[model samples]
Target: MTILQTMVSVMLAAILTDNYVLSKFMGICPFLGVSKKLSSSLGMGAAVIFVMACAAAVTYPVYQLLVAFDLAYLQTVAFILIIALFVQLVEIVMRKLLPPLYKALGVYLPLITTNCAVLGVTLNNIDDGYSFGLSVWNAVCVGMGFTLSLIIFAGVRSKLENADIPETFKGIPATLIAASIVSLSFSAFSGMI
Candidate 1:
């Protein structure tokens, strides 16, 4: 396939067929935690997108350097450090510019530092042997997919607030059920590309 076709397929696969949260099941903590409110979800999603993209951009070159030095095994450490730096940048910006969102995100903001999804994207890019541009594009697409899942689940959770249900299935149990159903719906996108 041409470069354009490859990019498009990668985008679709990342955002739909292989969503990190809904499909691959990475980063479920922030997915379930900060998704309680639409505003918070959007804020967290944007932060994650920025961090993931930046991490990919930096990590790609860093990985190349590591490979050249025969220190490739240190990639996980290097990538995590890069991801943490961006997450800190995001945290400072959010705290200064949007205190409410900063407060809303709470521990989850710092938790982004350890988010496996962000780290996973960087590693996946290297493992898949994608070029620098494709690596960054894949990260953005994956972040979008993460955002889409959060927004949809937030809507569902809001509806659940008003729905009558058995006491046994209330709260976390109900949320899990909703998440699973949403995940199942995403399965339809599988093989579409």
Candidate 2:
């Protein structure tokens, strides 16, 4: 297939049937925590997107270099360092330019440094052996999927915030039930493409 065709397919799959957060179950912490509020979810999603994109760009070349030097086993360590540094850079920029968003994101901003979803996509790009352009596109798509899921969950939570629930399924239990329903809905997209 052509590069364009490949990228389009990757984007669709990543954002729909194979969403990192909902489908693959990576980065559930932020998915559940920041998703309590729409504003916080949006900010967290943007931060994750920036980190995922940069991590993909930087880690691909770094992994290639590691393989060249017969140090492939150290990729996990190298990727962690790369992702951590990139998250730090993003945190600094957000703090300066978007103070309110930075404040809202708060601990989640630093938490992205350890977010498995960021690391998962980076490693997934390398494992898939995608070209640089495809890797970047896949990363962006995964980030978008993450954002889409977060926003949808936040909307659900907002509505539930006002809804009356039985005592047994009040807080986290109710949220989990909602998340399960959402996840089941996403499965309908499995046959989409």
Candidate 3:
């Protein structure tokens, strides 16, 4: 396929079929925690996108260097270190420029350092043998997919607040049910691409 076609395919696959949060279930902590508020959800989503893309960019070369020196066994360790540093940088920048958002995200910001989705995308890029450009594109697309799931679920949670429901399933249980339904819907797209 041409470059454009490849990019389109990757975007579609990541955003619709292979979503990190919805489909792969990689980052459910913040997906459930920060998603209670739309603003916080968006902030978290943006932060994930920025971190994932940057992590992919930085880790790809780091992994390459590891391979060059026959230290491929350290790929996971190296990737985690890079991800942690990037998350710290994002925290510093966000804290300075968007204090309110920074405050809203609070602990979730630091939690992103250990978010599996971010690490998963980076490792997948390496495991899948994507070239540098494709790796970056895949990472960005995965981030966008994560952002989409967060915003969509945040909207659902907003409406659910007012919806009458059985007392037993009112809070997290209700949210989990909604997320499961959403996941099922996402599964329908598996054969589309």
TM per candidate: 0.90, 0.91, 0.91
Clashes of 1: 0
Q: State which candidate has the highest TM-score.
A: 2
lDDT of 3 by residue, 31-137 (tens): 99888888878878887887888889999889989999999999988889888888888788888998897786655668798789999999999998999999999
How do the residues 1-193 of candidate 1 rate in per-residue lDDT, one tens digit apiece?
9999999999999999999999999989888888999988887888788778988999998998999999999998888888888778777888899888778664466878878899999999999999999999999999999999999999999999999989999889989999999999999999898
lDDT of 2 at 16: 97
Every candidate's lDDT? 0.90, 0.89, 0.88
Question: What would the per-residue lDDT of candidate 2 be over residues 111-131, giving only the tens digit for each residue?
Answer: 798789999999989889988
**For model 1, where is the 10-residue window of minimal lDDT?**
101-110
Better of 1 and 2 by TM-score: 2
What are the runs in model 3 whose C-alpha is more than 4 Å off?
A: 93-108
In model 1, which runs have C-alpha deviations exceeding 4 angstroms?
Answer: 90-108
Full candidate order by TM-score, most accurate first: 2, 3, 1
